[model samples]
Target: MSTIENLLPEELLETLRDRAPGYDEENSFFHRDLADLKKLGYLQMLVPTEFGGRGFTLAQASQAQRRLAQAAPATALGINMHHVILGMAYTLWLRGDQRLNWVFEEAMAGEIFAFGISEAGNDAVLFDSVSTARRVTEGYRISGTKIFTSLSPVWTRLMVHAQVEGEDTLVFGFLEREAEGITIKDDWDTLGMRASQSCTTILDEVPLNTERVATHTPLGPNPDPVVWGIFGTFELLLASVYTGIGERAVSLACEIVAKRRSHVKQAPYAHDPDIRWQIASAGILMDGVILQLEKLTADVDALGTDRDPNYGAQWFLHFSGVKGRATEAAKEAVELAVRTTGGAQYFRSSELQRLYRDVLAGLYHPSDNESLHAAYAKALLGPAS
Candidate 1:
């Protein structure tokens, strides 16, 4: 029952906030932040207590992520990759699946896991993979280039997926960082979320042990736990981060207006009707986003062990919908804050300026606008004629 208030206090948040700009400016990973988080046992928040973790639920993780993102969006996002994997394993484990118990054991032993699923031009997402997995003596040899490999600088274990060659199946498993044929290109410079160090990873026949393979399902989406686990945890965690950004933007906006005076009446902009209107609009959007996020997470939590794995479409519909709405609301909130803050937010020194840049990354994550619309269309209108 370690709440975010106890785990990430105001002092720690201020420290993270202080270092965020420096990390962004240097395009460096959040080494110090990562260290502090590890020390706090934040990395094992999702693993069960018996397994040496805090045993927090997905809902708690979402709330904690929101608080963390409010201080440092990039740092929150970088660690989110680790959380997503752990959350996925834990979500399935809760439903009586023991396939990923090793994940918890390794996490308890202090091993860091990074996600390596995203590929260039692979819009099939979890349903398919452009990367090829050739069957070898014992396990499959994964050979493909993965993009947006976050935590590239320090990940100890990487979870990846690839399409098996000559077979209509997809293979998912882990690869050791020290394993051969794994290359991490030092080219993570980006417009925002720079501290994440989400670089490109090239695998040249990296061997994956058969024992480590988590899923070997058919080529397309199915009623497997892996699909729902990944989609549910990824979408909820992603939504939480953007919602945090929106909350912080409004908070900063309020601070900015309270200090700046209106030239027309020499009164603080907080007293101006138009300024209030803008803040109110952003507040309204954020409120709705938070409600949607909470409802979705709660529903996932309440799902019984007998939950139907076949109910994948409804799951995708809600998860992607919330993620899309959260990102859109966050972007609008940031823009509104910038407009109210006037020229001050235009400077690189301003946190709002950084948030404005960082919020743009949300649109590029999984379930993009196009994907969101497509999911909604398929859900409401049935498959296209």
Candidate 2:
């Protein structure tokens, strides 16, 4: 209750089992029950101590995400966007963006923050977004349209990206949501993760003062420290969300098979060895995902607060590929649940449909599959691969 720790990771698994009643017809992003998150301060788990909020560890945050995913897929998504913003923005404000102290201070007081990185031109991290921020008399005039601005509808401060070409200089700066001339466009109707309210952000000649911009990427230490943590958080959350959906599908499978009457063998469908095998296969994949996450978490923790690495992008590459694998595994788990449950579970009331769509959304992260694998392999056996 005092926000000493993440509070829910250990408790949420139980609450999800007891409290989640599948999908309620009236439940959605604007639902009432989600207020439990804010009331309980789960929304500010990663806010820094100096900023007046408790900041949990990477593993704790990851575990909480898994637990939330089990409760309600939509609520989990909405909560995820909030938590990710707090974690990333909190870290940046606390460790890197010293000049932007007021933004950090406001977040500590429970102000919500969101990331607005995806733009109309640059959907992926590797792309050069066309958003331009030219120098004006007062500060800077930013003109751009960013799509998929998650958590913006409800969040207070949004961290945005724009470029500035100085005298022989090109720099990236992080701007605030309240900056003059910035507007949030609520047009997000994605096939999945809809509860996140991922809308478009319009920055039409926004004026940013000296306090709004964070320094170049990797505000902490290395050549690209900022991106490293963001990438890592993205990868871990991918695994956690998928793991949640996988657990849900498996649970539904167990329920249906238990009720099934084994007309062929004169026993319940629960006794069917084939169905059992399918469940076992799904379990195997889930197990694989957990193992990979364990390894990834440990590897990241080992990196510590260190500065630079020659193979700086190694972790980023690993995250992209592993995320793809875990996402596929989660999809398999959901499919197995639907397949083994038969046609009856396909009803409109079934939660499996929503979970199915959520897992599918995990597939499109705009990454390089071959490049990821090749990088990992090259790291192991020289760059020949």
Candidate 3:
């Protein structure tokens, strides 16, 4: 079990932390950070060991992501998009589905994959898409705009999907960054997680050859292994990042309480029972998030190649719960930290203030509270009559 402590040394994390604020303040991409990560072979963490990579499991990768988020939330969140793609491919490979083995091969060859699945108004998730893929001589011509294309600055490949013309299926494929009619719009200005550079990507007749297409699946839910792999990996990794944020918030709160002095008592705020209680509460909330993350990751690894036929629905139920809980826990922990640390934390320069804004982005991700609850209801009580 190669932990993040061994894979990503403390010195690298410290450097990432030092660079994080500057990137956030400038609303720039973490270019240097990405280069360093590549140098350290962090991008190949999910590639199989036989393919000249470390071949880490989901449990190990989740742990690594949690630690990365503690140093730089935006960086971790942005890179997580790439990791999710690889994680899904690796998961399917581990389950005896070698359809996506090329993804691992590409990773070993030093190609970076970015996610391009999000659209402006369509929220049907993996079940539907607004983009259209017109049949072409070689493969398909993808024409649509994708939002929140993380790793926009440096991704060599993009994993995208679109509805096939005159068919009831959607085409999932990878497109080269330099493909014709591809435009990356620099419109990612937001409240927090600014360094992620998750800009809008436009595709106008972007051509993908036959080899680049990964799969063609029917619209809506089905028993597709790829779909389940993606949903599971994405939700779990996203949850892990926010869990890291919560843990960092709790740590910061403890440090503040230990160092700050009470004017009335002329003693450290740590001595104040009320402040101690707040810190303890934050710790407890973060503990729940971390435990859920750990358990879910372990379950994912344990599934191996023997997953049950109905495991997809069960996985969805569990993933939705963990994602929602982790995000909420992170937000609550940051709020408690802000309260315990005083008004200074309200300033723009305060790390807690940045964390406060960053944690809010968690709410916008897929499997949001309403959708998560809906899935849970469907799984628990069965669909409406």
Judged by lDDT, which candidate is best?
1
State which candidate has the highest TM-score.
1
lDDT of 1 by residue, 17-112 (tens): 999999999999999999999889999999989888898888888999999999999999999999999998987887788899889999989999
The Cα error of candidate 1 at residue 46, in Å, is 0.5
Q: Model 3, stretches more than 4 Å misplaced?
A: 305-312
Residue-level lDDT for 30 in candidate 1: 99
TM-score of 2: 0.81
Higher TM-score: candidate 1 or 2?
A: 1
Looking at model 3, residue 15 earns an lDDT score of: 95
Worst 10 residues of 1 by lDDT: 303-312
Residue-wise lDDT of candidate 2 within 35-136, one digit each (tens)?
A: 566777777666656666665655566766776777666566656655655555544553455544565467657677666666654544522446666777
| Clash statistics: count for each candidate | 0, 2, 0
Candidate 2 global CA lDDT score? 0.64
Clash pairs of candidate 3? none
CA lDDT, every model vs. true structure? 0.91, 0.64, 0.89
Write model 3 residue lDDT over 211-325, tens digit each, in one string. 9888889999765777777888999999999999998999988888888998999999889998889888889998988888888887888665454343556777888889999
